[model samples]
Target: MNPLISNALKKDLELYFSEDDLSRNLYYTASLPHDLVDCKLKLKDDLLLAGLPYFVEAFRYLGDTSLDWDYFKKFEGKTYKKDEKAEIHFQLPFAIALTGERIALNLLQHASSIATYTSKFAARAKDKGIAILDTRKTTPGHRSLEKYAVRVGGGYNHRLGQTDLWMIKDNHKSFFGGVKEAVEFFRSMKGFYTPIEVEVHNMSELEEVLSLGIRHIMLDNFSPEEVKRAVKLKPVGVSFEVSGGIRLSNLDDYLIKGLDAISVGALTNGAPNVDISLKYNR
Candidate 1:
């Protein structure tokens, strides 16, 4: 289990239950045998599944959540029929059955939904070197987990956080007086090793970054034609990324424009939960 996830889940559970006395009441009634037990998960729609570990991890840590996963019953990046059942065997005290079930399914459905949406966009933009990138615009505490699903569904990730890489956006440029000064400041930092990405809205700024020889650039809010032109004008060896208002519907315009990658906020923010359910198989 990733330490980040372990820490986040611990924090989340602690935060949610700080004032609640329900944990004791809920645990007693939901406990199951700490020996082998059978449970199954079902989905109501076809989806690209991801984040199985987080689902399992959440349960394992949640007093009743860990179970012996039945590998043969799993979906391996394949589509599933609606109402299909997937099984796992685990031992838990019956006292916390409901608690474990709810947490596991919630994580599974939410993560899978993001993966489903990402897969759809990635498939549509296959080829043209146009990788689908998930932005840091993710659920605040669930960044790593959500980004993991994006990767599982054939998409790539942008910077993980402010510390992961240097992403100088328009606001930073304005706050620091101008783009040139920001570029020079970053360039001057001793022992700096991270790749720098600057966001530009127009051709003039793009030209300015080109002079700075920054290798990664974001073309924010550019029209399809402008993106194409920017792609042409990009300094040789520099990669171009597109963001702001990108959607599955208008993807083809940018896809055909031959941008290196497109980052969509919807991959995490507005993704609808893929319908899933739990059914007891007798």
Candidate 2:
């Protein structure tokens, strides 16, 4: 399993079981005639399936050691229509399935939702040779899973975490006196070769950073017309991205030529979970 997935799952399990008290389930454990049962994982809505690994891992983590791993692996990243009634059948201990259902579905639904939402933007961006990117505005502990879902939906990730790239945003520029100072400070550091990206809020800021020789730039909240102008000013090999106030509705307005990518925070933050559920097969 991916270490990030494992770590997040561990934290989720600890938080959930800590509050719910697993022993309560054990109260009826002895009365149940069967320890293991067949089950169906059903989709209640159309969705691009993601995080099957996490869902399966959740059951394994909860001691469902005999799960049908091969059966689940085939469905990852598959898109299913609501009317099709996508159903995944497997068998696991009844108590373990019940205990891990929500955790499993939570991770699955959240990831699938992000993937589904991102696909819309990605499909639109792809037509213009532009890439759709996801922002750092993800659930605190679920960054890894969320970013994974973004990729599954055809979107690229900007920076997995702060250290992945050196980004000088408005706040960083304000504290460091200006964009030049902030850019130079990082540039001056010995062996700090992480690619630098600066968020420029206006044309002036754009020109200043352009002179600083920053290769990657994000035009913060720039309109389509403004982005077209910024693109004209962009030197050869410099990449321009747009962020802020971007959504599916207004996405086309910003798909101007020369724009390298569009980063949408709503991919993870605003996406509603795709409906899914797990139930006994009876």
Candidate 3:
């Protein structure tokens, strides 16, 4: 495990354990009926599968036992016919009815939903010279997990957070006079080690940042036409990203306008839980 994840998962596990310790096997010790063998997960509709590892991990964590995990997909990095089955094959190691089934599915369904949405968007952007990007508008404390699902769905991540990269947004724009002043202030701090990206809301600000030699520019809330114009006016080798209020309905329009990347907050914020069920398969 990455040190970051090692530290974080340990903390999360401790929290979960503490919260349920009062029950003292009230949930886990319930005797399950005979002949019930395995729980198999099935998708209600075709979906781009993701977060399989996390689903298994959550089950193992809750049950404090292991079960076989079986995965089946018709294709890799592609869509599937409707009504396909995605299963998690496993049997309880003991005849104990698990109490955390709902919680386990909650994580699986939500995470898979983000991945499915991301995969759909990424598929549309594919071969169009545009890359699908996810923003920081993720569930607090689940940023790493959500972003990991984005990658599994074929999308790229923008800066993980402020600590990972430098972004001069409108708030920063206010502290300094404008883009030029902000860029200058950061440049003057010569020892800093991060790429600086400035947000430009309109053409004038775009030109101002370009002339100041900022390597990256973000076009917030720009229409497709405006995005194209920004791309045309940007200096050679300057990277541009588009963000704000993007959705599946209008994503292609922006891609068609030739953007280098587009960040959709809805990937994590507005995700709809994918439908999955676990039932006895045998």
**TM-score against native, each model:** 0.85, 0.91, 0.83
Order of quality (TM-score): 2, 1, 3
In candidate 3, what are the lDDT values of residues 1-282, reduced to their tens digit?
A: 123533455555445446546367655455544344677666676666665555555555654444434332222234443555555466653343244455556666776788888988888988887888898998876786788878878899986887566788998889897777887777776736778888889999998888888888899999888887788886778888999888988887888544688888999888777787767533
Clashes of each: 15, 0, 0
Model 3 per-residue lDDT at 241: 91
User: Cα deviation in Å at residue 115, candidate 3?
Assistant: 0.7
Candidate 1 lDDT by residue in tens digits, 57-156: 6566656434544552266356665656544344444434445566667667878888888988999888667999999888876786688888878899
Give me the overall lDDT of model 1: 0.74
Q: Tell me, what's the RMSD of every candidate?
A: 3.4, 2.4, 3.7
Whole-model lDDT, model 3: 0.71
Candidate 1: residue 246 lDDT (0-100): 89
Give lDDT per model, in order.
0.74, 0.86, 0.71
In candidate 2, which residue ranges exceed 4 Å CA deviation?
1-34
Q: Would you list the rank order by lDDT, best first?
A: 2, 1, 3
Candidate 1: RMSD to truth:
3.4
Q: On lDDT, who's better, 1 or 3? A: 1
Question: RMSD of candidate 3 to the true fold?
Answer: 3.7
